[model samples]
Target: MALDKKTIRLLILEDSQNEAERLVSLFRNAGRATRVHRVTSAEDLEASLGQIWDLLITAPSSAALDPTQAVSAIRRHAKDIPVIRLIEGNDSDAITEALALGAQDAVPQGEDERLVLIADRELANLEERRARRAAEVALREAEKRCQLLLDSSVDAIAYVHDGMHIYANRTYLELFGYDDVEELEGMPMIDLIASCDQVNFKEFLKNYQHQEGSAELVCGGVRADGGNFKARMHFSPAAYDGEPCIQVVIRTESDSAGLEEKLREISSQDLVTGLYNRNRFLEMLEPAVERAVNAGQEASLAYIRIDRFAGLQAELGLADADLLLSDLAQLLRARFGAQQPLARFADDVFTALLPGSPTAGAEGELRALLKQAEAHLFDIGGRTVQLTLSIGLAGLDEKTARAQDVIDRAHRCADEAGDGNALKRYDPADELAAAANRGSVVAMVRQALERNGFRLLFQPIISLRGDTYEHYEVLLRLLNPQGEEVPPTEFLAAAKEAGLAAKIDRWVLLNSIKLLAEHRTKGHNTRLFIHLSSASVQDPGLLPWLSVALKAARLPSDSLVLQLSEPDAIAYLKQAKVLAQGLEELHCKLAISQFGCALNPFSTLKHLNAGFVKVDGSYTQDLGRPENQEALKTLLASLHSQAILTIVPFVESASVLATLWQAGVNYIQGHYLQGPSQSMDYDFSPDE
Candidate 1:
């Protein structure tokens, strides 16, 4: 073994100058440049051992200069350095005794390679120790800085580990009626919350353990005097003293200052429920909408209504009904806390702004909460009443530019789902078509199909990693008799209802392939993404038809990708599996769009062989919010882990590009890149 040009510090115990010179020559030949210090007597060896050295080489000598005695003396000064014993011959007994005395290794004389290898190994180990020691020192300094910040901070902050307080800032000590942090340390976190909220706080922690980002909740805080005050607490995961902990920030109702500011806050608050009034909610929503547009992330508005609320108000007096609403508001606040903004949109109707489109867990929790509320009987001045809730959720997207429009859509959806008291998502196409005459819409779709009035538009999907192939999603638009383009949502439902989806899919496929071939001839390598309706998933002849179409156009089968929505794929799982396999056989790829919406999305993935997954639009549209960003990062990680290329759709803003790149998404498509166009043209230059 030859060492690289690293200079070794060698301390040798030898009586002969010739032997020392020979050892140094061996090391130099092995590429180890060394500074050799030859010491013979015990006093010289002890004095030389004071300096730092990499290795100690002891050549076998007479009784006056014993290698074992030198090894013992070196250990007394610095036990960490490796000691190599040089034996003149094969003396196994002496090697064993030398090792027992602290020799790191034994090498035969003239074996320069063995000595060099031992020295290199000892040097590497020492470097590792130094690095670990430096890291420990840095951690200690970080902890001290954290402590200093805590001591100087005016805001009440505390840290808890294993549900017990481990540390508290000065402001926290003052607010909790304690003199020192030591007094607050080791106290149970529940003890700080009032008796009524203790149970809820415990439950919150259980759910929060799985939550990715920081969360806030309003609870009753108790002071040393046993007085309770409403307080908002924020919990963020943190590390302290090299152990995991939760940092808590507490703000009380009395923390606000100045009468004028307080009055202004009250002006925006609903007196009956203490939630944000309609005007305030609308004001807040304007910025939220702007943020969503600029951040290219999804934010959602929820409209909730009480079923038969008018009858309940009639049965109970107006005052009593108002009391019931107030009680309901309190319940909402208790359950959701400050996770998102809540407002009283109208009489008996509430609206909530979810910054990040609610997760599947959030959706389920709300559904369960609604069920619990429905089953609970309310007592209003001796009168008993039961109410069900209808909730409608509408996510902010490129089309939903106006806050008022989103709120209106959500309200309309909730009213439409009133009979079933269901939770419905706002579907733009469905909302628009509901206002049109159904017979006229059906006739219009049929006429447009017959006239071949449908036009294909392509939207480029940009690749973050600079892939050479060009990709675009083929969108369809139906031109009416007046030459007006009908929104896909409006015409798609009518077509599906009239059993025209299969024909429509065929239309889209044929046009996309024709366009792809023409674009390829112009020297553009392009692939088009086309949607497959549920009807097409069951069309056994679709694959054969595609084979003929590809052969006719002389287009590569892989140029066209078939996309199936998660809901449609799940609704026709067996057929979807067959279609996926068939598409594979045809050398085409299958992509599952609107994925991660199912109760068990990965379960559906297990049944199908999909090459790509487009994460649901709701999750990607709100990348501006910190919580949403974290959620998207986690989802992208899962998709990448499974070796499935992820394509995040609805990339409507430039701000989201960096985040998407960081997440390692394969492709991105949205209005910001370019709306669907008649020509398959998008600037693919790296400069852009």
Candidate 2:
């Protein structure tokens, strides 16, 4: 089952509402949507424990409730909630005490970054525990169902371990002329065989255990009533109660025909919607992938997910949700046709394979299906509910190596398109961009660092409100052997993987500072936004190194605005926060580029003292859409209300100038304004 990635349910033990809000802001800023419940009393903590919570954060100095009491309450209720204690200052004694009393970890009260990091780790561990619990429950239920099926089978079947009978169905007991399975439970299989055939049967069983496939033997059998009969027994490797065993199926001449076919169909089918199950779909996919790779045949696979099905399930309940799912399965089967290989891959996801079809054709079919799903309303127990579909299509060709990889790619694309009722086709270019063949790139990065073969370019961030001060974002490129500049997107990832990201970041900072110091000597009040990778953000030695570098260049810290991408900032929130604090101490500024893409962009700003935020370029590129325009306007309004200076990038044309200006944007940067050049020569004067 997929864990909910959108929201985290938190229980905070604190006396002050302000402090509680501060804690919530930490998670929010880290791109986590949180539903927080703050409790200051033991009664409140006990009541809250009745419900599920992801993590429990308690203040050791709370006046109304002690941390010990909160931990006690959780233990009494047998809750699995992880506890994090907020201690005063850097009290090592208090941290040790809290852990001894059942807390997972303890953080200093003012160290909000540490708290956020600890909370993130605990929440991840909680998710894994929950998933394991769900798996255990499902396994138990499956075992029960398998037992029921085995007991109800007509063929005589029994399971044996080390030649002793462990289990036998009713038919097997009746065939042996025993009234109860208990009577024959401990009997050896050789004892059941007639004396004359015992030696032959022993040799056959020994050989069967040493082989990989099934084996059969026709031997004389002795019943409990001293009667004899000849029967054919099939032996296959099996497991019982988590132990290796052998499964024996005995068939007399009078047994029914077509039993094997019926069992095969039952094993491959899903009892819920009557479609093929995930295992069966995989069985079919493997052969299809082989045909595509070996025979040059073309095929396309699509992963379909029901949008907001979790919310739908919560509203309609599990029973009605299953009914709705059945209705959806029927609709999918009809649309894809009976010959297509389709399966309910997960609770709210489906997979389909179209043989001899290209991605474009498959995408068209999926779009039509999406439209149909959007139009049709599903009725479950007289309640009508409308839903939309998010489909991801991936083509199978000689490039496809593994069936599982294709499924994963399509699944990722579906998740990317989940926000809207849309379809996304898997693009191999994205994979190629982040490919693992980074040996050459790593070598290039190291050589450039050693020889100073790196170059920096600057693009002017033109102010919409006509501010006099000049601003430019620093861009990095590597000079290859042929003097061609290679973009960071091509090699930065490789450098990061090679543990050289921090070195590269430091090199850029040192050179950029030197250039900025020289430029300032020309009487221009300019500031540069230099981007940092996640590795640099997490580096403990970076701040000290940066301080020394800034002083060596004799540049004002404020003139250098360090920037981080939204994803990197969110991923390393704790480190980013610490870095931001350190930069503030040095009078440097922090800016989050590619911002406004998270679930809560402003939440992150609340935790960090960010002076500038560059909105994601998609907002500017998609300005042609009215909804996108309004979205950008609203996002800017939120940022502006917080007193944040907004920089809108990718201003390719003048058409968006009026909209951006009306939205109170502070700066705009793109090719239309001024592309990145070797020299920072753009004029920042007002258009008089």
Candidate 3:
């Protein structure tokens, strides 16, 4: 036999010296990575326990010397290190038992790879487990930090889903007149939603949550005893207690607007440059367009797209990238005064609006910066990097007409054309199609309103039991100038996206009210309803304008019902709630235009004292389908039980009308009765 080394730290736990010396040879010849120690007896094991053993062996004669206990104690001291138990072929059972008991592996009288594989795999598993534990601990710490921040935030915060309150801040409790968070924990925020908004509050929240991860949900709420006020709310879903859930924060509208202005945090502020954020800047665009047109002043927008940004990101991690952006924002702020609004549009992109500044001068300055920036090196993590830019320009010429339009054109030019910091102006012919579209849309709308180019139709809403015409719904028609009629379904979306919904709503409301008031004065006992859009609700100026207009028309508030779309209102809930409240204070009867959009919490029904719920057309329009009819029946029954009037819209035929009547509909409106009219003089004569 071959002995590898003259001497080593070998005191094998064996009863025989011959077998112990043979096993010791393996360690002496073991690879440079190994440092092993061994003991040969139970007493020897105890004595060697004080020694740091990287590897241990059981000699053949020590089979009965409590090999299990000896190996177990060795494992406690060197959990990561391997132990090779020497075994004979006839002792497989004892070897298996010893290996299971804590010995890393059993190597037969000869050398084998199995022992090495076992040792390597076990060591790797131990390391992975340690890493996972560390990661889990870090995640826990992060979650705790987020929770602490949320709890102490000034905004009233909460989480609501499926009409259930899952989380809340103390500020939320105080806002709603609750004494403790515990009291409000399981209560729906809608429970305190003002009486005038109860009918659609849940619908609004559902809609708002679906708008951009989170939107500012503004609405009116009643204090514990019922005093009403407006609130600005934010709700976004985040993981809580390992479950995906919503997190909400609310600031009263007055306090929110005031606080925002004081903090100079307008909706979305470019945090780095401290300028109006992209969202607010976009909002300011339309006004800027109008201002330019009114003042006959020229304006241009330079959509600056960062080139080679991803390369920079790859070269410098996020922290260094952020620092680089901060530096760039500082340069922009210094170059463009605070009055010239600027924003960090995206991670690497920035935009600046130039007013009264010549396009050529702006071009010259940007060109100079581009040259400097291209050659300028960023030192990050001992690495140097450079960035380039691409610019697309749009001016207040025939090419780009509105703020969003200008932004899109500029972005298209920058993105589609060029390499580093190349400057290009918008091409009129390039955007002629879009311009033509705008002109066509505006002309179509003007024609609809001017030539009485639209139709006005009414659907009589009969009492459920009485089956008498108690009210009528005023519908719209978009038509060409030649009296060729256009369907509302065809143009409502275009009207909305084109930002003409509010004007259209105003026109419809004033006309509907005038007609309804006429019938009321003639002792006809008629009430007419018209729909309002979310855009109109967003405009706080609308309510007072409506009040003044209606008063001027001498229309009694109750005689003219105002219809509001559930989905639209829900998206702009806070605004919707406030607008509804204003209408209620004016004694205007309000109805949800599309109810049962989603499963709204019944708790939301406590506000709005809503007189009517227009069953969503999907549920009522196709009573021909059993599912549609059944859904309508269930909805009508549920609504009627709450003493809420149910109106079925889009009744195209008498058969559909009769089915709705049997299903307990409180009113009916649609094409089979009358198409929309162009003027308030539309007469819903029984004979017609």
Q: Which candidate achieves the best TM-score against the true structure?
A: 2
By TM-score: ranked, best first:
2, 1, 3
TM-score computed on alpha carbons, candidate 1: 0.37
Candidate 3 lDDT at 497 equals 83
The better-scoring model by TM-score among 1 and 3 is 1
Give the per-residue lDDT digits (tens) of candidate 1, residues 530-575: 9999999999989987887787678989988899999999999999
lDDT of each: 0.78, 0.83, 0.65
lDDT of 3 at 408: 85
Range of the 10 consecutive residues with the lowest summed lDDT in candidate 3 = 1-10
Residue-pair clashes per prediction, in order, are: 5, 1, 25
For 67-92, candidate 3 gives per-residue lDDT tens digits of 66666555433223345576766354
Q: Which residue segments of model 3 deviate by more than 4 Å? A: 1-439, 446-455, 467-470, 481-490, 515-523, 601-604, 621-628, 656-658, 677-688
Highest lDDT scorer: 2
